[model samples]
Target chain A: MAGRSVVDAGAPLRDRVAETQPSPASVIATEIKGLVARGDRDQARERFGALVAVLQRRALRVAFQYLRNPDDADEAVQDAFVKVFMHIEQYREDLSFDVWFMRILVNASLDRLKARNRQQRFIAPAPDDDERPVEQVPAAEASSERRLLARERWEQVTRAVANLPDRQRLVFTLSQVDQRTPAEIAAATGMSAATVRVHLFRALRKLRGVLGEQA
Target chain B: MNRREEPDPTLADALDAYRAAAWAEVDAHFDERALESQRQRILQKVAQAGQPARVLAFPGTTTSLRPAAGISRRWISAAAAAGLLVGLVTGQLLHVLPGDAWVHRVAPRAAQPYPSGRLTLIPAVATTDADNALLDAIDVAVTSRGASDLRAFDDLTFAYEPR
Candidate 1:
């Protein structure tokens, strides 16, 4: 096994910040919006799949950051896409469709989180029950010792991120996981840009402390 | 101060682990098949939501009595007849019930023309052709053609008086 630390096994990240050019999803969404305005819901729905395909992975990633469980994240994504189609008319064409869709996805995730909290109050889970469906990708090349250490660090990181306050977690996930700029995060989240940067700073500072303790 | 513009290098490095682990889990959980299934479900849900909500018709609460489109004319006639029968039965039951409370009546003490005023009605009897002819004679004189026609009224009689 190659001597790869947790830092070395980085996720294949997409540079969404550099996607400044016009998005094809926005074009499709605008066309669907027009069809919906004309009362041609069937045509609008027919064209919505392209939009879903474009945003599904990113939506799942953002949703998963809020709702740690994969199934809940999936449900949240579905809810977001359905909401997008149902309320396509509300999407302002002058703005980026990604921001509008991200807003919906975040709201859906929060809704799932709230629903899960309500359910948990009534039905508490067992102490040892692993609530998240975290399937460890089998990096067969890594030695057993390295794999174990990676998994342990993974758990610690996940727990630290999960323990953050909702806004801090949101900003961190958007900035780190989704690679969105602070300005973009503010637009999607409805927070002021300064507020977004402050949240990001707080989240990073907290993570640094958490990792330092773990180290 | 400008260092604050860039995130701390150590913190960035530490965050990679979380990003890596989270992405691994997301990718493992939402594979191609799972994503496709989710896509289909989203489409189905949107299609369902795009349509109007289903309304259940409750007879008691509905404000408009819209005629049932599927009902035939014969059925309508039968319904009308059944309704008529129910009304007639209700009317008969009201009549036979004790105290006759359904009928509003004036007291006999209050049933006079003016409480104590006198009035009379003639006794009814079957009339013969002679009676009709006498009435005709009276009518001819009373019509203002001439009072000389009153001569025919001389033959008029109560008829039973002679009997």
Candidate 2:
């Protein structure tokens, strides 16, 4: 009877173990929580190193479009990552971690942009030599030649985006570049859906005109 | 520039293609490895600071009685010190009494028999109640100059019935 009782207990234990396997995101969150709770410096460093390997490049790209400066954009992405780890407890399981993390990156970038703008009245435009003008180049240029052309086109696009009003720029970047839906952009930017749509429409129209002039 | 004119469809297509190309260019310029290294360094610094260990030990829990206990102990100690100060002052004042003659002047003397008047009840006046008249008489007796040695009246009890 004792052996039978022991077997019964073991069966439940095995079932419970099977029932409790964590998903990848949850596991990551749990490991982060544990590191934070234990103040485990080495583990935290490794975990963050892994997380950054996964997330940093994408975050930098997104931040750069908003901030324009490579250094500022890098700082913004780093700051956002730190904030994400620090406030991991507040992360809801229902949302995609990438979306949640990107939201932080966007907000951090925007905040830095606002602060920099307040300190300096204007964001200095990248030098004309730094920007390769797509309009000046012939379509039949060599592959190596077209690389410079691509760079110039991107520079013009960046300038056109920067010249847009703040709301329009934010909406355009979040929607057209980040691939966020209108609703997501509205939620992220604290604008109404209709307002976000209007901003997006105006931005696209302005960008079209700018590109058209160059063409 | 004309508001009423329809937008050029070819221009719209070109803009879309340009936007896509722009994002690809931005992505190509991003340095992932450098960002990862920075993130690792920040995490290392934070972990070295010991915040995670502290947070883990009391995860979701606030310091319960520990903080209140410390505050309360400080308050009690302060109160005890105040009480001791007051007691010392009182003891000193008690010990530093006046001279013997002054004590004799203040202390009661040997009792000497004296004539006393009985408290006769007066009928209630048209404007005064029985309770009020009695209270006024007692007040007058208590305030009189020779009423100092009225020991029986020291712990006087007055009883009144509701009218």
Candidate 3:
């Protein structure tokens, strides 16, 4: 009777965990948590460093777009990693640790923004270097013209993205800069998938309009 | 594309290209130097976190309270002797003071009845609520004065006959 009761309680949990194969990030996080549990803190810390290396560049990219200043972005990323290590024990084994870490990163960026007490600056679009008289570039240099136009378009797109409402900007950065999907972004930002899609659509529409107007 | 219309594939393609270009530019801006310095700072912080905090000290600077190199051991011994002598003299003076008996008397006078006087016994009665409240207040006041100070004043009382 005891054996039957134990199986009834534990079988489904084991099956469910097995059914969803853990991602690499989740696997690494679990390993770190295990090391910490066994009292091998040094090994856990080393593994955590590896995890940081894996995520740091992407985290910095997302943070930088959210906070225009490099220093603030750096601080936010560092703060996020520190928090992740401090709360590593709280990580759920079933969930993707990447998304969890990203959520912490997003909160860290917002915290830095609040701490600075500065309104998000709407950066004015700089004058296009490609806007000089078409005659300046010889008609034969088609590649150079294409490159110039691309540079011009890129600037306009960045400016438009920068001017978006903070939520839309956050959605766009996660989607575009970090290449996260709408569902993943929803998980990271604690918003519904529908909301994330709407924000992304609105952001893209604004960008398209800016480009069209420039063209 | 019309504003109300669905997003155009061409526009999406262009935006994708722009995103790539922007990422490349931003990635390049984070150059090797900046990335290395930031990484070093982060690792330094992590290493520091794992260990106990150290008080910041300048290089080659000693935090010890020892005297300078020129000061001899004889000087140190002399200073120590001086401190001990001063302490002993102070203790002696305190022992000879007029109120010294108060420090030595461990038995409170109230705890033992007045030694040489005729003792009057007040009949035991249930204390009134007002009397209990007053006693509680006194207890609190004595407790707040701390155990050592309370012991020092253990013999003192407020009970006295009006003239």
lDDT of 3 by residue, A145-202 (tens): 6756656666667678878998888888888778876766776776667788898888
What is the lDDT ranking, best to worst? Answer: 1, 3, 2
lDDT digits (tens) for residues B77-144 of candidate 1 = 89999999999998898778763243223233333343322222211221355446656755765666
Top candidate, metric DockQ: 1
| Native contacts matched by each model | 0.61, 0.28, 0.19
Model 1 regions more than 4 Å off: A1-20, A128-145, B1-9, B55-163
Q: Pick the candidate with the highest lDDT.
A: 1
CA error at residue A213 for candidate 1, angstroms? 1.6
On the 0 to 100 scale, the lDDT of residue B2 in model 2 is 19
The value of fnat for model 2 is: 0.28
Pairs of residues clashing in candidate 2? A36-B52, A37-B52, A37-B56, A38-B53, A39-B52, A39-B53, A132-A152
Estimate, for each residue in B10-118, the C-alpha lDDT of model 2 and write its tens digit.
4444444455565555555554565556676656655554454544546334567677889999999999999999999977876686545444444345223334545
Q: DockQ of candidates 1 onward, in order?
A: 0.29, 0.12, 0.10
Tens-digit per-residue lDDT, A41-89, candidate 2: 5676567666666666667767877786777887887777777776766
Per-residue lDDT value at A55 in model 2: 65
RMSD of 1: 15.5
